[model samples]
Target: MPDITHSIDIVIPSYRLEKDYILRIIRLSKPEKWVFKYYIVVDNPNVIVDEEIARLAASGDITLLINPVNLGASTSRNKGLEAGSGEWILFLDDDIKADERLLHNYVHAITKWPDEIGFIGLVKLPPPPTAFARALIINGSMMIFGIAEEAESFAWGATANTMVKREAVGAIRFSTDYPKSGGGEDVDFFLNVRDSNGGKDYKTLKEAVVYHPWWNEGRPSFKRSFRYGVGNSYLGQFLPKYTYYDFPNTPEALFLMLLAFPIVIFIAPVYLGSWGQLFIGFGLVEVIATLFQAAKRKAPLSAAVAYYVVRLKLAYETGLLWGNIARFRFAGIGARFEYKGRKHGNGFFQFNTYKIVKWVLYALFIYGVFL
Candidate 1:
């Protein structure tokens, strides 16, 4: 029971993804009392959409645009923005399953929240059999909805599911410089628009939501994890907020794992704490992390979740190292650990919650490097 006065225009960018997803999203997205226009931009050059989709566009059911070249999601989204003519523009990934009231919630949220700022909605992924993905969704990614703060200079709204006033975005567009997938394009575009008009910013809308099938098929492979790592590199190169979160922070980490792990294990018994104090201290971190996330989500704990989570962590870290190599090849990029005189991240805790230690260590390195 919320306001239903505003209309919605949706922009969905598709690469090599399936065509049915777009239709499914459109089907579930209709809301009561609000008009919605759909735009599906195909990024692939060779593959044409089925005749039905083209006919739908012709019949005014959807607006379809085909890219002559595969310019990536960010670019296609910009095109979608240009094609749209509504008061607000909604961005949705191809894989999402919209709630029956998803559009309704968004309209309600826009009425409730500040009109000048953009809004990032919630994304729910189906529970996966792998521990890594579950851990990722719960600990590392979009699951947490703490509190919202004003961030005009920098915003990190994910493009997967978000709403923004057309007037607020104005002429601002996504940056084309980052890797097509890995760069912080979502944040870049939102913050650019936010910062343009006298620092109007973005807020989180916890009620406007959708579900994704990210982990439903199976666990992601190491190659996929590596690509994510590579994308993380682009973020470090493009966004100051993720500087410490990227590969430039990894040399010492690699050094420690390769050289110090065995030494630490050997010395644990040799230096022999007369009490179990040392082991207790080491065990405390894992216990705390597990409890913190579980307490928030109230999710059931199990052995399987534990196993894949560990694997996923290592896979991404290794990708950071490899990502550095990839970055070097494309264009020489280096990590600037310290961002003291610069702004970073959307809000204070809009960073990796699981690796506070890595962030701290990287901060020290950045400071020491500058000195």
Candidate 2:
């Protein structure tokens, strides 16, 4: 780390967090050579804090703000940010503690990266051991809480363990206009920053890692994954930033999925005159590739495990379908208005004149050709 000197306000918005988790974060966040202040905003004031944690609050080592009502992380975080006075505000999840040198990496990255960089993303270390956790990790989605890989110009990052330049984040705040249960306000909050802030990007300090106690909470892991899938539609619905993360774990997988739907229909007749043998070839290659991917995993995977992973994948799909329907139930009505994005056909509700034609072609190609 360079000889950099800047104050950081560690903001934690808590809701029913464990005492041990709270203490661990409070301890690990206090870097030896750094000037930092810690603020823990209790979303529900009635949620009891242990004696040691309360003492720390009384001693001024940590500041505790109480929200009269439980407004969830997004709203509580905004309150913490408002109270924090520092050059940088490091937003951390109440349940997660950081790497020993996490703060150092964030400070170093801020000093090192270009000024256009608005925030530094941190890696969420391998989650706790559980069947659901393992499945969620293996069946990955970019929207999974506190997940980041590779230091790139990626704008979306979990606020669970990230540092943001306080000045760069002007009027932008986590959107409380979303569902209390459906998440993505954290990810969308930063994406909105990139959109309005002269195209500012966020980078990862890969070593700035935190341990997540995955699937330890009361909510079933599958339910959480499903909720995340629904929550994802809110990104495109509100901000117009296409932060829609795909359900397929990889780009190849995504392409194969899209291709499979049509390509399978394109085949399935006599292999000669009407149907494509090419589709069969593609399917064989895809199966081999998928098996190869599963084999390459560090842990030996079994057939049962693979099936469970497939189930998790479907959970995401279901969530996306349900979420979009719920979010855009009135989109057709909104399309009629002469608004910023609607009137000129640039909006999401554009009249796709060729839409039905494309589907009709698929239907005709499938039945007329195959049968």
Candidate 3:
């Protein structure tokens, strides 16, 4: 029986409104020193409402809003925001497994730092169950929320677990321009809040933890990555200052060029005879070098992992290229965009030895692939 000083609205947008999952979250959330309300927005209008969920809604334990038609996650979140009447709005994903202390920690942080506009909670991934999951973890695909956990303050955090002040989010809504599959809307929403408040005051609260399961059952999925890339194209349109031409710089761009090199040799054999073969040989050597390094590191599945990594990376970039083409931004077909507001650490050299070595290898690989 702690004194309640503030109110929080926990907003979750879900397409698959799982009753037991939502009930688990509600049961685990301990709003020790604050009053909180759950706002569940169902994005799929066709989803049948659960009897228990409807009963909870009727009992006022939660506010359930079923969309009249299918809407994207962003629009669903906007609907939740419109319905809530709390001082803080905590955005969460329906799939996440909430920690028992999730709401309690947030309430403590909010009380301790009343002036802060937002706080990002830590979203952790369970141990990788498969080789592909391990690869994704190592390659940084599964570490999006983990990265924010290491930071004291960050530019944007995934809506999977984040709390924002209602005043700071006044009139700011998640962008509906992204693809229906969802991608850049979370980033766009936070960036908009940051811009409106004119500060990077969102602090990271590592104590509030949530677990997000890997998609596709810990297996590799190109479609999900490709959709993310397509969604990223909208970021460039919304925030052009961070976007730049990616040609001749990124490994993805270099890989595309390498794939097109044979056409160049075939078209102009006289101009590029043996040189083309030599160039391709160098690329082969780069691949061999990578494998050798992996062997030295004692990673048995390095070859398979590397193959999947390159394949997924290419898929993402291709989707980005197609997205740019769809938007008629021909010049930005090979564009590089950095929507993540701030970077942790001082410079590349300041990174730990492992990171430095990884970056050096990447640079060498890029150079070799470009030739």
Q: Write the per-residue lDDT of candidate 1 for residues 186-299, one digit (tens) a residue.
A: 656765676666565466766667777764466655565555655555555665543432332333244334454566557764443322333333334444444444545665
Note each model's CA RMSD in angstroms. Answer: 8.5, 9.3, 4.8
Query: Which candidate should be chosen as best, given lDDT against the real structure?
Result: 3
Assess the local accuracy of residue 143 in candidate 2 as a C-alpha lDDT between 0 and 100. Answer: 35
lDDT of 2 at 167: 76
lDDT-better candidate, 1 vs 2: 1
Better of 1 and 2 by TM-score: 2
Worst 10 residues of 1 by lDDT: 145-154
The lDDT per prediction is 0.62, 0.61, 0.75
Off by over 4 Å in 2: 1-5, 29-34, 114-116, 127-131, 142-148, 217-220, 241-301, 327-370
Model 3 weakest 10-residue run by lDDT:
343-352
lDDT of 3 by residue, 240-293 (tens): 655655323234444555677788778865646444544455445445444454
Q: Name the Cα RMSD for model 3.
A: 4.8
The lDDT-based order of candidates, best leading, equals: 3, 1, 2
CA displacement after TM-score superposition, residue 213 of candidate 3 (Å): 1.4
Runs of candidate 3 with Cα error greater than 4 angstroms are: 1-4, 248-301, 342-371
